[model samples]
Target: MCHHTQPVTGVPLNSCTSREKTSILQLLTLGMNSHTLPTCRVHHMEGRADPGRVPAAGGRPEEGDEADAEGDGPWPEAGDPRGEVGDFLSLDLGGTNFRVMLVKVGEGDAGQWSVKTKHQMYSIPEDAMTGTAEMLFDYISECISDFLDKHQMKHKKLPLGFTFSFPVRHEDIDKGILLNWTKGFKASGAEGNNIVGLLRDAIKRRGDFEMDVVAMVNDTVATMISCYYEDRQCEVGMIVGTGCNACYMEEMQNVELVEGDEGRMCVNTEWGAFGDSGELDEFLLEYDRMVDESSVNPGQQLYEKLIGGKYMGELVRLVLLKLVDENLLFHGEASEQLRTRGAFETRFVSQVESDSGDRKQIHNILSTLGLRPSVTDCDIVRRACESVSTRAAHMCSAGLAGVINRMRESRSEDVMRITVGVDGSVYKLHPSFKERFHTSVRRLTPNCEITFIESEEGSGRGAALVSAVACKKACMLGQ
Candidate 1:
């Protein structure tokens, strides 16, 4: 447990007292274990309760258990193809949309798989995210049914891979216990229910599909797996769109909680919940607090609120509102456009900041907001972008640093090539996001080699691979 508080001082735009800055930096150095800090208190929101405090190391198998290494059961030996070539269906449930794809794995190179048909992306309604599981799954089932009908897919019992993009506790490749909802989902039945079983039942009700659900995977984990299949050096998968999270391979021994197994492959760290310690740089400002306090999971993922696209625009709004209230900038505007949540998307700000043609970009941005830009407003917009982007980069680096530290501690290696597969609109499209992330990594790990691989293969393909592996493992065990 670590606790540190600093006085807010200086102009809202620049400079923190040296002493206060030092204290905050010290607080961050305590690492993720600083959860017990007295300042860390869970905030209350209607319809949102604590997700039953997760253990410090997450609830997965601990490091000490031999089972932590090679999984709870036996490791499948080499030379076995693991049913690499098979027809499998995959589903990718994302924050804003859901996709389902049918893929056929070809026997040849390890990770070279081809999609049999075009994938489908359906824009999910906002209500579905917060409604009952039946409602959500029914909608998904209809999509799947429509896909199958359009493609004339065989009615046989083909295996299915379910890639659920949320925080879930898994006992194996096939089972996932829902931890809590992220990506704007607050469905009642989905919170604690078995997602695979729910989807399976939903599909079964249609009577036209007889798919066997085999594996469940988080989006980041799937990205990692997919990347690893293509490039063995890939070790990390990160998502930075509506929300931010990273998954990286961890040695089984350092986990401390697993009971058995020794040669485990990797443990997905799910590092989004990191940096919730409130030890962030003073730029976190009161708007950040309101965002955190009002979120479904308050007092958690403070750093995410600073960086993730889901909150960046809102942060800008808060800061802009403050500026207006203080008559500092953007004064005498309608302010009505900023009243709604997510009124300003992160991309809008990024566009303004990336604009290099004199003040034309700034003028365009303000014009879109129905506000004529003054020189001060232009400066304010540029400053806001820089502050938000810098804070995001710094916090993102902290997460990478934690993972690198964990890896070094577990392996005791001098220098290792770490490949991080990143996905999401913000990461892919946001200018300077990559540069800032690289800067952060370099600052944190001077000796390590890091590679960033952008992957188009999302949870859909990754889940299919997991399903194939699971089925192959099951068949081998039966033999």
Candidate 2:
């Protein structure tokens, strides 16, 4: 939405007017306006649950119903990881790799549940990425069976925690109704189905996959739960990679569906699907528009397309293409390979930004497309990459700021020291990402103390912890 036109000065990196540069920075630093963010969108609908609503298992609400705090149903009891002691099976359906891990959590040195894992990795095949839901879940089931067979633990009905990351409305902790697919997933028969049922059926089809799914979790929620297991102070868990989303420990009283006696629970606020045709739509830059139009889902996940890792590299390419058109780089020569779709990726940005001595990696990446860049072009690429990624980091911090402030306002008494456990490649490996995230968070909410720590195995280990909780809750409910 930033209305900066082409520079009349010429195609030099520094030739752009101050207004043009500021527009890009504003898009990266704060988004269109603070109101166009998830913070305002969520605040307006915090407690708007419809009293006439009946909780349905794997239910889908009306169009605006997602805004209702409890319309998605009561937040399930997430079992305490602190006192959990046992060997639990965990399955992580990540974007790139599907993982099945046996996490051994038992009493350790400080009389706490220590986690150790017997891990197995299965590289999800290309066909499964865009294939049918059956193909995807069946493959995952096969991997589970393979892991059990390799470990010589078969025919055992072990507790399983399934971490399926997507938007889902869960009636209970162990089930989720798929809202829609993201992260370039276009598998048929995926949306509007229960992922737990799909995987369970897949497991049933595979006789060796005998474990019961005790809990179903989102990757981001698992990260928060994973961190909370280690440190009780961790109230938020997040994933900032191909896409960005956050989950936080919310007081149950505020959840309209829950009775006053129920304790606190974790809420998966699918904030990645944030932004719309209001101020946010009006604020879209030309590159952002291109990213969305070229994406699998157009006019959706506006925030994600602008800031998520999957689109960051594409953003760089879009900008580079613009420069090329303006005769800025490659002596105004446009490489046909650069115009090809999906040529540049987030990895290229990482390589360019992390370059210290020479931009060899950047050059090599571009070389694949048969283009040799000069020093000036390389510098321009690095700076643009940095700017795009910096914006992602800052936008992530802003969303977290909204979450922290919302929780703090409800409590209002203690100096709420919330800890956030973040996972994903962008936050974990990108240069200056950690510092940028921390700084932006501090800038937003200086009064409150927040610790943003990197967490791995959130989907794997966190699911195991949730399995422990689900089992305990099931037993208690029975009595």
Which candidate has the top score in lDDT? 2
Q: What is the per-residue lDDT of model 2 for residues 1-479, given as tens digits with 9 covering 90 to 100?
A: 11213322223434445765554444343234433343443332232111112122111221111122232122332334555577789998757678899988788797856788888888888789789999998889889888988988886778998887777877666667888888777788989988889988898887765878878888887787677656767777889887877776565566555555344556666666666333356557888888899887887777777678888888888887776776555666768888877788888888888876465666677778777776556656777787777767766777777777777876773666778899988888888777887887777775688887777678788788778766666766787
Give the Cα lDDT of each candidate. Answer: 0.63, 0.69
Tell me the tens digit of each residue's lDDT in model 1 across 317-372.
77666556644555435456766667777878688668773656766776677776
After superposing candidate 1, which stretches have Cα over 4 Å from the reference?
1-83, 108-117, 154-156, 275-283, 358-362
Native RMSD of candidate 2 (Å) = 6.5
In candidate 1, where is summed lDDT lowest over 10 consecutive residues?
42-51
| TM-scores of the models, in the order given | 0.80, 0.83
**Candidate 1, residue 416: CA error in Å?**
2.2
Clashes of 2: 4
